[model samples]
Target: MADIVEVRNKQVIFKDYINGYATGSDMVVTSDATIRLELPKNDDSLILTKNIYLSCDPYMRNRMNRTMEGNYIDSFTPGSPIVGYGVSRVLESSHPKFKKGDLIWGLVGWEEYSLIKDTRTFIKIQVTDVPLSCYTGILGMTGLTAYVGFHEICSPKKGETVFVSSASGAVGQIVGQLAKLFGCYVVGSAGSKAKVDLLKNKFGFDDAFNYKEEQDLNAALKRYFPNGIDMYFDNVGGKMLDEVLRNMRVHGRIAACGMISQYNLDKPQGNYNLLMLIMKRIRMEGFLVFDYYHSYPKFLEMILPLIHEGKITYVEDIVIGLENAPAALIGLFNGTNVGKQVVAITNE
Candidate 1:
């Protein structure tokens, strides 16, 4: 190899601990950041890669906080580069499973280049016909979330009445479609009219509505699920969860995934309709994708065929360049994206 050299790396740096919603102010992109062209030392399992696409997930907002007690992942260090799930191409590797030019998906930094220290989370990209950026959402963690939450946790049945909140999102879109494939009558609620269209048209939901237009959430649920819902895949919590509880059929099951509604809330509101759970004998469970990562290969086996046959479709709202990362992340909460919001740092 040539003599080691430092290269200027364009990076999005986390500036401080955030409270409430994460704003663009919390992060700053600097074009002058530098990284060595070679690995530092003796890290045989580590892989050096160039990031291609980065995911902007709601769960990542929790990682921007300073607390460690209630959060699932450790807080991002202030003044350091923030990291999340991403797709990258390995440029140099000491790991036996990877080599130069191998594309992989895993946890990576919000920089042009990253020295990925852990190999445990890494998954070599085995398929490429689909958009490479898709690995950041569907075909990656988001797809796994829907598979485990709906099929495993919720245990959907044929002819069951299902509902999905935040239905136009990465996981929500897939979850709704899976419910339909399972022979369930599915309804989904989104924040905007465009998302409502995407849910009903692209993802093939039985019914979809813009939640913002509903003055009474309970009434909206009643209109869609007149017979009451059998299964609910919850992405946004807070009022949506409470309203869903009020409309669930007896023996209903709820798979609680991410609570994007309460992600930025410092003092989260309690659900008043929770008593309906006891009355209806409903089962509500919260799940993390990490718990079902072992089944990822199986998930790929199941979805790849559906994708190939055009039985399933995924929508992505991708923004180009690492400099625009902050706006793309903040836009998730603002209803600015049609489907999954992904930042394309590079295509290589």
Candidate 2:
């Protein structure tokens, strides 16, 4: 017999396939029966782990919709626990690659305890100097997304004029800082005054503006980049991207990371100025972070030193308890989370 604890596990479940903008009500928190530390009889193919922290990302919004066509990633099944990238500790392992007491980060069920069969998805943490929660943000997918998308896709040059949208979010902040380190004149656009201030003061952006306050995003971009933008790290699609396309300089590069602005729409807003891409001979490409996993080791080698030297700073908005997971997940669509949103399930 295995020892069992009465785990008060609170989990967020997808009510149904979502349509249009995601809402807090789209997900509900429910409790499950207590779980044991050991696997069941004849079950030697699973890894039991306790989730430590859960990440809330904009990409998750796409997983909520049923009709969305690009089956590149499977949609979360309804009535089941929603899943996302998280940091966890192995409690029991049946797999050879993972052992008990290993701290890892990867795709995890939204519940407190997850019995994962595909153990290969998990990445064991080799560095413990940084906060463990960083695996959900800067040191994890978000950081790699910014690094690969900027360096690999955009191919930035020193002294070039760069513009970033949603510039104060997890990936955006890092992208702006990296551009600055490469000696680019970087400007960013955020949703609020506080985030704009953070872009300028904390992230070392040349200039930043509250896009919500700007009557015209095109004029704002033009005002900030008088000579025109050489590189655009686009996060918010729709109007912002449309304006950016119009303002791009010849041979400019655009790395389309995410389109948070259009994620919730029934029909994604289409760009009206795409002709500018052809006229300016611009290069635009979209990417998923997982595609760049091969380069993760090199990315860590470059970013870890910057983090230790304080050249890069990461911000997290942590919500405690699994009970708060639904609210925290929903906050991403509403732009309510100030930094990288995460749910801290346990102190350890």
Candidate 3:
């Protein structure tokens, strides 16, 4: 008989349809007993997996509301396991592309082990030089988002003045660093004093500020970029975005990576300074990371070298154990996470 530890699969369940701000209690973790890993007797199309790490993203908020329509991302079903990108180790594989011991990163259930049938979507991890948890953040979707949003969307130029909101966040951190490497004068806005300090002292942002402390966002932008912002990476939308629009230079570019500010609101807020885009000849565009999936190889080529040479740095805020996954994810909305939020399961 195979020795099997009682797998208490803890899943974050959606309480109900959300209207206003989301609370940690909105999600409940239900523990269930799971059987030991077992290979399919006849099916050669399924792969049993043990999730090692789970990614906590801001976008998951969209899935909470059932009434919201036209959202390209799928909503999490009530009374079922919440799904997101995860780094997992294959325990039993029947797919040709994956083997029994392969480490992969892709969409997986919140529980301990998942029987995934769609192996095509999963990317097999060939590189082990970096930490496995990074697959959930910098080395994965977050990195890809920063790369495509910066290089492809913003189309930054040297000596340009760049401003990034949520600058210490998963995507924002990389975006600011990339802008710096491109020889742009970069400034960042973070939620906390600690995050602002990390942006200036650690992440090498030329200047950074705590958005919470700024009474007038327009004045804050003027203080950072006196000449005018040539590129704006809009991570937190609403007031910050409106201020950036007001201060953008002619032909400026804005890459709308995320709108963290509006995620918790029942009704989306409108920017008062919409006319500024016309006056400044600014180009604002929203992008999804999956849109640039074909260019991922090109992105990896550009970023991997920077990582190896120590030209780029990544910071992750890891919460231990699958049991804490719900709290880790809920913390993102409150700006509790300092960097890329990830749940480290098993610590291996």
Candidate 4:
């Protein structure tokens, strides 16, 4: 029998259920935990994995809340390591589908090593031409969310005017690019001039603006979409959604992908312009990415070629070490990350 190997696992523990915005101090990183780098006896379904790269996304803020009453996903336990999407290499596995040395991406704990029992959601990495880190953002959940939201939900048409909020971020960036590629007139809004430039110049958005500099968001939308918006890919909900409701054209479609602006608030902001939906015959729909996992293979087929052909662009803001994961995650709320925020645990 092979001698068992034991390794120390560093984990980012959630200090407590947060009441307001989360800070770096809210999570405590400890190196005291140790685990055997092999599957346990009698556990045929367990997979022991060494997490390689972790994704820090805006949706994670909701899981930090004490109660996830109406949320689709469960809240993170206060004393345990937080969990999110990540790429991992299997160290040991008793499962029939996965073996030692297999690379996969799915939900993983915020730790150096994780003992995963459920492999249903995990996906094997088949494409090697792109960086493995892209599995965390562009080629993973973020990419699928953009594809499903725009292609499936919005039902975009050629020559349509599409506007994406938070357009320099992970999902938004892809949405804007797809819209531009689909022959739609695409415009985007970001928080900073740098992000604005990235959306316009890097992502090929027809136009882009800094939302922070705009005193009146309604006027900003009008300046970009003088006629009216045919479709709106909303990322920041709150006031932006309210302003967008008034600018939507008749029979316009709105894909509510995320509401990052209202995630940390004690009481979420309400949209008062909802009446416009009825008046303008607009269809505003909210969707969860979990509902569309079945279409991932279809998404992969479309995106992989675009990536290889240099028809699309993906940017990642990666921080070295798992210890810096907390800061990288918190940076999302303030627009500190220019693109997809990723944490690299180890290259091995």
**Top TM-score hit:** 4
Model 2 regions more than 4 Å off = 2-8, 41-45
Query: Residue-wise lDDT of candidate 2 within 1-348, one digit each (tens)?
Result: 445554665677788997887887888878764666676667666788999999999889888878567745888999888989999999988777888999999999888888888876689999999999999999999999999989999999999999999888889989999999999999999888888888888889999999999898889888998889999999999999999998999999999999899988888778899889889999999999989899999999999999999999887999998778888887877777777899998656
lDDT of 4 by residue, 11-106 (tens): 999889887898999899899999887777998888989999999999999999988678888899988998999999998899888989999999
Model 1's alpha-carbon lDDT is 0.92
Off by over 4 Å in 4: none
lDDT of each: 0.92, 0.88, 0.87, 0.94
Top model by lDDT, which number?
4
Error of 1 at 248 (Å): 0.5
Q: Using alpha carbons, what is the TM-score of model 4?
A: 0.98
Please give the ranking of all candidate structures by lDDT, highest first, separated by commas. 4, 1, 2, 3
User: Model 2 residue 271 lDDT?
Assistant: 84
Q: Cα RMSDs of all predictions?
A: 1.2, 1.4, 1.6, 1.0
Which residue pairs collide in model 4, if any? none
Q: Write the per-residue lDDT of candidate 1 for residues 1-348, one digit (tens) a residue.
A: 567778888999999998888799899999878888677677788788989999999888888888946667889989988899999999889889999899999999899999888888899998999999989988999999999999999988899999999999989999999999999999999999889998988899999999999999999999999999999999999999999999999999999997888878887887899899999999999999988889999999999999999999999999999888999998988778889999999644
- The residue ranges of model 1 lying beyond 4 angstroms of the native Cα positions read 1-5
Give per-residue CA lDDT, model 3, range 208-257, as digits (tens).
99989989988999998889999999888988898899899999999998
**TM-score, cand. 2:** 0.97
As a TM-score, model 1 comes out at: 0.98
Residue 213 lDDT, candidate 2, scale 0-100: 94
